[model samples]
Target: MTYHRTRIRRRRAAALLAVLGAVAALIGHRSPPPIPSPTTLARQLTVAAGDHFHREPGSGALGTAGGALPDDASVFDDNYPGITRLDPDLLSALRRAATDAGAIRFVVNSGWRSPAYEDELRRQAVAKYGSEQEAARWVATGTTSAHVSGDAVDVGPTAADSWLAQHGAAYGLCQIYANEPWHYELRDGAATQGCPQMYADPTHDPRMQK
Candidate 1:
């Protein structure tokens, strides 16, 4: 009976290990993603500058938008979550990128989620995740918005993100948020210090938006 119980315990241990291994592969918890070379991404984004640095580091898999990117009239290219008109040079850069890639049309995963939309998303996250702190860590909203400036963006991949980090200087696009890997900004190296400096004014925040 003792030997039988020991065998059962070993079987259970083996089962647990198998389950953990499967979970690791599903989430890619072991290794880092294969980021593209700086040259490859520069070709992809249609920009080439020597001094570049990405503020955001990762990509969101179809966060708010559906599956792959779509060239829908409702979703304008290079717009914010609100579909606000983007900076002219910014638009030209993105448009040129799509025309060159010949693979994926530049589509907005989200142009802008309005203040109301942001509040709702926050509420939903708090309800599901059990705390505002947890929710905010995952989704940003309102007063702490990057969408208001019409300068921020969340690209599709780290490879692309890495490319932007390496060569986005000439185009004026910079990753914006600190914790959110998908968020970025086109600061253009204004007299501002960073997003924190730019958003210090309530006027720049979405919750403060009219």
Candidate 2:
């Protein structure tokens, strides 16, 4: 009876190991996305810049609508509605940060986004992630996205993000997500109280649920 029990335990352990091995193999087979080069990012920004004022056909919904930013976009560039439409306090803070940024230029990768533009992005995210639940980690619906409400901005290149991470609190701009280093929002008392803790991702944010 003892020998039989021992054999049963061994079989269970072997089955568990096989399952674990299969799971590991599946994970290992999934390829990570390629990191875009700086040039590629700049090109995408240029495309976004020119796409301003686009409208979604048949829906009467504004797509870019002057809300798409360019690679060389500055905080003070009000010509683009994207920059001009940001929450007034957040825009002010960004301008101040820009002046003091020095060699690290604060390039606005994205600012305000039209509901139509946001919806399109959400669709693309869902496609890329293979499900809305997984995509929610990166993109939110127009009603839930801070960008659509002009309360958030995505700054870049890598140097600018790093600079903002270090000195943004002084201007009340705070990174809200641990996963997106370039995304920032205005925190009213951050200049004095320091920034609050970051959410793991948008999926973890209470604001995203609504």
Candidate 3:
């Protein structure tokens, strides 16, 4: 009888251990991986989206031109994001600057674009410019646009140009290219000194950049 009792106890202990192991495995499988920390996200934003290397001699030169995108992609002006959902600080500064400047209308040709949307833009730009490099200097790869990280904006109108040039540094907003008078970014000069990471892939949809 004592032997029988010892065997039964051992059997129950083994069963319990097995059950616990199974449960632990299930829990581990169900949980998704943790998102990168804020620090890492900030770093990614810096490099992925910053404007340091993207700078060129004559960006924004076509602000006065109708349709922000190349003629082919511009066919869908019906598509770009509205001015309201852009970076809070940049948006606010634009409002202030626009209001102060009086009649300085800022044209938000694009904002918070998705990677997929960027891809289409790239396609149209490549068609127009004949090369990705040329298109990149013309617009942006979704990954590199300050707008991808919600830190940049495209502005139109020459009146705001001189104003932003003088005050943009004060508010942390800077132009992506010298030619494009309308594009602007938050100073975050420290946030992306060497241009840490692109906000998203140039081919990414604005929605997915985040």
The candidate that wins on lDDT is 2
Candidate 1 residue lDDT tens string, 80-161:
2234444455555545543544544344443444444445455655665578665554445654655434444455445555
TM-score: which candidate is best? 2
Model 2: residue 145 alpha-carbon error in angstroms? 0.6
Which model, 1 or 3, shows the larger TM-score? 3
Model 2 agreement with the true structure over 1-210: per-residue lDDT tens digits: 999999999999999999999999998896889987534443353344335434233323443353655456777787777888898989988988988998777887788888777776777667755788876877788889999899999887888889999999999999998877889999988989999999988989999878
Write one digit per residue (lDDT tens) for candidate 3, span 1-210.
999999999999999999999999988886678976533442233323223212433323222111123211221133423344466776776666666666555555455555444554556666755677655554565666555555666554455667777666655566645445555666566233532233333333253334
Candidate 2's C-alpha runs over 4 A off are 1-63
Residue pairs in collision within model 2? 53-65
How well does candidate 2 match the true structure in TM-score terms? 0.72
Model 3, 49: alpha-carbon shift in Å?
A: 22
Residue 92's lDDT within candidate 2 is: 89
Q: What is the lDDT of candidate 1?
A: 0.45
RMSD of 2: 9.3
* Best of the two (1, 3) by lDDT: 3
TM-score of candidate 1 versus the correct structure, residues matched by position: 0.45
Task: Give TM per candidate.
Answer: 0.45, 0.72, 0.48
